[model samples]
Target chain A: MTGLKLFSRRILPQLVTLAVVVGLISIMFPGFFEISIANGRLYGSPIDILNRGAPVALLAIGMTLVIATGGIDLSVGAVMAICGAMAAWGITEGYGLGLTLLMALAAGLACGLWNGLLVAVLGIQPIVATLILMVAGRGIAQLITEGAILTFNHEGLIFFGSGSLFTIPTPIIIAIVTGALVTLIVRRSALGMLIEAIGINLRASTLAGVNTRVLLIAVYMASGLCAALAGVIAAADIRGADANNAGLWLELDAILAVVIGGTSLLGGRFSLIASLIGALIIQAVNTGILLSGFPPEFNLIIKAGIILIILVLQSPTIRTMVIFLSPAPVSQADTEKQAVNQ
Target chain B: MISKKALVGAGLLASMLMMSSSALAQTVGFSQIGSESGWRAAETTLTLQQAKERGIDLKFADAQQKQENQIKALRSFIAQGVDAILIAPVVATGWDSVLEEAKEAEIPVILLDRMVDSSDDLYLTAVGSDLVHEGSVAGQWLVDELGGKDCNVVELQGTTGSSPAIDRKNGFEQAIEGHANIKLIRSQTGDFTRTKGKEVMESFLKAEDGGKNICALYAHNDDMAVGAIQAIKEAGLKPGEDILVVSIDAVPDIFQAMAAGEANATVELTPNMAGPAFDALAAYMKDGTMPPKFIQTESKLYTQADDPQAVYEQKKDLGY
Candidate 1:
């Protein structure tokens, strides 16, 4: 497909929604988009949105794959807490930065392997398998931190959360790099097709000699690793591991981002760039609400209203209705192409 | 009423004589809410420390943030025939039956850090800081520190609609009500978390002319204050000097901030709720004095003038 046609077909809807949100925010606060530099780092509301949205964006990258495989991982948030606690514990124990990160990622891998085993080997439902860790993972994290916010002052480790490169925040850079690498790997190899096939029909994909078991485990492990990265960033941002609040209820946000990006929860094709945009949309609304100076009580109501409008605009029924009402006539081939793309 | 006073006086003397014999071996049961936050954890630690200092045979029960578990622990404490019981109830409702049982067992139940919805007479007294008073103390500190300067204040509220949030906001507003020099420019909820606190404060800084317009910040909790402090520093402003930081809940970390001159003042929602409860119990045991229905713990305010580092050291090991 031509780049313009591809952009118009797949990316335009989300981009428009994002633009509208940003436009509304800019209208409310005239300097919403103005970027300034301070302390050798980019500072502005836009940068804040990108920086704050890093965790969700990272999760969305992995979540897109999991959802595309027809499996849900409800344990990312708790995994975040677990990995953060591990990192905090390791740092405080005088471990080097490398060792602390390795331990944290290892913890994530272990959690992912546990969930994978339950789903792939025991034939448990994805939701149930992850639900176990979703509940217990926070407790494990609490134990690791001894039921306190484990504070660390390791500068090397803190750099990931707060340090900047080229005046851009480290978190933004990390998210971009992680997204690009994951996208390249999945698209470069046949792994994407195999995962999509398994999602479409697990029995058929298994009969077709796709290593469904190993692929399932690998997919969950990827999700776990992404969650660990998010956890580290969150912990590093605050310089502490808050077992109770770290990544609490963020799995839902990641899932919402995936759904808002036009990916089906029932499984099939997925788009990482769209999901990243959806994460940004969520953060933009958040930043807008904060800047609007509305009462705290109205925050949720306003966010819910804006998100509802965005979803309604993205609804397929409304899209078709808009097409039907359009002045321009669409050829049969173009209409068929639109349907297949969706 | 005069005759009743005489009769109570007589009863007091009679109980005092009987209580002195067993005073050294007094046993108490403490039912604590789970360590949900640093403050709650500190309360648990202080309770244990208080029990140990008094040489009281203390049986500690963790309710795990469940009303059911608290009720169960209360029943078991009553069955054990403890002299007095201290409970930090997880919730207000569903305590009528449990309190009634404790009363029937002749055990004085003193609530720690939280109150129950049962009749006042059901329990001896509830010892907790006045949430509104805590907020007002924080606000009053800001008002005094501003010294009639035309200062714009930004508030970091707790979870929306929470009792502490509402009461703290009200108390602060009440404190600065007549101060025309002070104005609340913006207010938002940070959900009482560091992450949300930092994120919300960043937007506040952006909206308020990059932290120049705002002169003070009031957070409902110290954690949020700490987060906002970071946001202020990131915006290239000195937190304590450029914008005064005042918040409630003197968690250990806040003292660290204060020692570093990053935070200005904090109103302590003192976790030593058990200290007063135990004192009242001791007084009641020594003489048949009925403690007040409610005991308001002190909402002490700490500023940079105070020895914040010493306080931090004292509180650091308290599990906060």
Candidate 2:
């Protein structure tokens, strides 16, 4: 596919939705997009959106591939908690940053391997397999923290959370680099196509010598690594690891990001860039809610209403209806339809 | 079988010394609602310490935040035929049958920190702090400290619609009533966690012109206060100095913040509910004196002036 066609087909819808949301927010708060540099870091609502969206964005990076492989992970949030607790425990124990991060990432990888073994090896359903970890992972995290918020004061460790390079938050930097690296690793190789083939028809792909089991396990491990990075950033942000609250309900957000990015949950085609945009959209709505000065009670209601609109706008049926109703002169929609058929 | 035989032997020994004063070496079973938080862990520690100080044999059971586990623990306590029982119930309902069984066994049950929905006769008395009064103490401290200054206070509520959150909000509003100088500029729920607390406080700081307009912040709990303290500092303003922070639940971390002059005051929801319960139990055992239906634990306020460092040192080892 040509670059322009790919951009229009995959990324345009999310960009439109994001622009609309940001526009609405700017209307509510005129200074929403105004950026100022203070304390050697970019400070603004837009910057906060990127910074706060980093965890979901990072999770969505791995989630896009997992979802593309026809698998769902409900344990990423719990894994994040466990990983954050691990990092905090290690840091407070006087361990250096490298070892602590390795320990946390290893814990995340172990959790992912457990899920992979249950699903890929034992042939369990992905949802049920991941649900086991989803329930038990928080307990494991609580155990690691000893049912208390484990706090650390290491500045080097905290830089991942609050530190900035060139006025960009470290989390934003981490998310962008990870997204770019993962995109290259998949797009520059046959891995993405293989995962998509397995998602479309596992038996056919396996018969075609695809090595489905190993690939599936590898996808889960990738997810684990992403969740670990997100967890470390979260722990560093607060300077502590709160097992009960860290990354709580964040898996749902990550999944929502993937769905909003126009990725089908049934799996097949995927785009990492689109999912990153989706993550930003979610964060924008959240930050907007905070800035809108609405009562806390209305926060969920407003979010739900806005998300419903965006989902409806992205619906294929709605797009078709729009094409029929408008019948534009240039007929870009018709060409796009032809491209999909081809 | 061994546990049963030992229990019978202990019961026989107790009966043989029925005429003794105060049931001096009495056995009591405590059903704790697991160590879900540092405060809960501290409560468990204080309960054990109280039991040891009273020379009571405390058979402890951790319910692990499950009502069924709590019920099972209470049944085992009943089977053991202990002198009395203490329960920090995980929930308010589904406890009638269990408390009835304890009553039938002639084992008076005292509740700590939380109350049950059963009829009052099921338990002797509940030892807990009045959550609203704790909020009132925190608000009263802020009000008196301001002394009619035009203060724009931001409130960080606990979980939305939780009993503590609702009661604490009401109590604080009640305390600040008629004080036109003390105005509540904004209120939001932080879900009683540090992360949400910091996030909400950051927004409050931004909306209130970078902490210049906000004079005080009242959080429903000290954990949120600690979180908001960091936010205040990050916004390039002093917490206790620029924006006074007063919160409820004097957890150990809050005292550390207080010592650093980062937090202004805190109302302590003491974890020593067992101390009062043990005292009441001792009185009842010595001379069947029926205590009141509800025993309210003191909601003490601590300020920077209260030797916060000493308080922090004292509270650090209580498992908090």
Candidate 3:
């Protein structure tokens, strides 16, 4: 009974969401469940759900960490755009794949460091600091491309986008591996505790000798790396870099996924698995909308409605009401004893 | 103190005398959509340059692609008592009330690069490419190339609620109507970005069985088509050969792509619609000559047969 209650408290929301999505998709498409597994691979449209979910999953992983520290990074999408443009520019300028990848990663790290300096040293608000980068990054991307779409003749880069290992897409593989590493870091390292402390009580944590500034910067830097990796995969898939629309409006979806995964925007807790599940749920919803014969415009309304429903479920008042509405009652003798002890 | 007062009185008298002798230049207020695309940047630069050359006092305001900001700028322009107004609307709808205000102010308005959905006839003329014609030319070229054979095509659309997206789709459908063999298996808006174009094409590739059946692609603009070409190449198929591609807007990169045999063809939508636009605006300003409602620009289709290097040079000269 205790285990069941704990699961309900910790994991039930994601599970319920998964069930609802599965039910809806299965009902709408008759053959959704019939998957053929051949040569150690599962073949179907489900592969697309996983593939499309990868970039958002990467962003959500980083966003979950930042939100746990009571901060937000609104510039991930722009960072991705800049990184993509840089990679494409590098490759087109006759640089090898290794150099291009290194440059892209370095650009992302530099952007994060810039954001960290503003937020940690200069005392700018996280949103304001990142927002400046968000506005400037796209401009920088345009400058690099000269407002032109750049195509490269690099095969190794294309492989990252289209190649598969054991029949699994490279992007999906990267997402899963990166997600595991992030999960391990947050679960096993002292950094997670420090972040939680800072979020819960900043003054007290600083007094307790927690390096709040460094942790905050690290979180943002990690977010930058994640966004950069997503950019590489995206650019690789496209085999080109487009400054105009690469990673556009992606930050919104990342934030939504993090919030839906049960991380409080106000800070203090995060669930990596839940966040991944949140990314999957959103992708599934999008695919479901496409397969349901509804026009694409309805997808926005459906996403907004789902987010609202999840937020309502997270309300403290609703949880309390649900608890009170249960048929089981607490023992009065124990309550009286507890009162006397107090 | 007496000397200082005499000097101030002399300066005021001199300014008043100068003001009385000189006529105030006609001010043309312009509300531009933000510099989101290369074409938008070029248009803004041309408008400013032409205004300066013609000695028109152009008060420019950028809306950063927001309708509210454009409306605010227009109201301010009206308040400033400008003689004329110009607007490049971000979206086609929601301009009735604001345009009515401009009409009440008796200011002649010109639409540039885009059109609004107001029935008030407040604007003098729209100067832009026939977007539908551009799309039809692309479609007609593809039809001629395919020779009415069965071909599956995918499309990358532009931003929704925009006039170009609606008109381009309509025109393409009209051209491909009787050609039943050219089938559009997948169509979605890439919002006129290279990334979304690539992303949507990626999904299309994954959904289809190895993307072997996709015969051709059509994009509302060249940027998305270029992105689609990337996707096609990444899928291990030749772009221009295995899958013929066509799009509107002969951006320089499209020419480069065509030169490299990655893209098949594109219809030209010259970004230099400014010259003729200013000509019409000048007439309206000088003599109150109401120009025709639609001033259409010519569009041409460019294929691999055309020397891309020469086309590139010509387009670069046109400030593309």
Name the weakest run of 10 consecutive residues (lDDT summed) in model 1 chain B.
B7-16
Give DockQ: model 1: 0.70
CA error at residue A88 for candidate 1, angstroms: 0.9
DockQ of each: 0.70, 0.52, 0.19
TM-score of each: 0.94, 0.94, 0.75
Better of 2 and 3 by DockQ: 2
Candidate 1 residue spans exceeding 4 A from truth: A1-4, A327-342, B1-24
lDDT string for model 2 (B140-198, tens) is 99889988889999999999889999999999999999999999888888899987888
Ranking by lDDT: 1, 2, 3
lDDT measured at residue B119 in model 3 versus the true structure, 0 to 100: 83
After superposing the true interface residues, what Cα RMSD does each candidate give?
Answer: 0.7, 1.4, 4.5
True contacts kept of 1: 0.86
Q: Which candidate order results from sorting by TM-score in descending order?
A: 1, 2, 3
Query: Model 3: how far is B124 from its true place, Å?
Result: 7.4
Give the per-residue lDDT digits (tens) of candidate 1, residues A184-203: 89878998888889789889
Candidate 3, residue B13: the lDDT equals: 60
Candidate 3 accuracy as lDDT? 0.79
Worst 10 residues of 3 chain B by lDDT: B14-23
Per-chain TM-score of candidate 1, chain B: 0.91
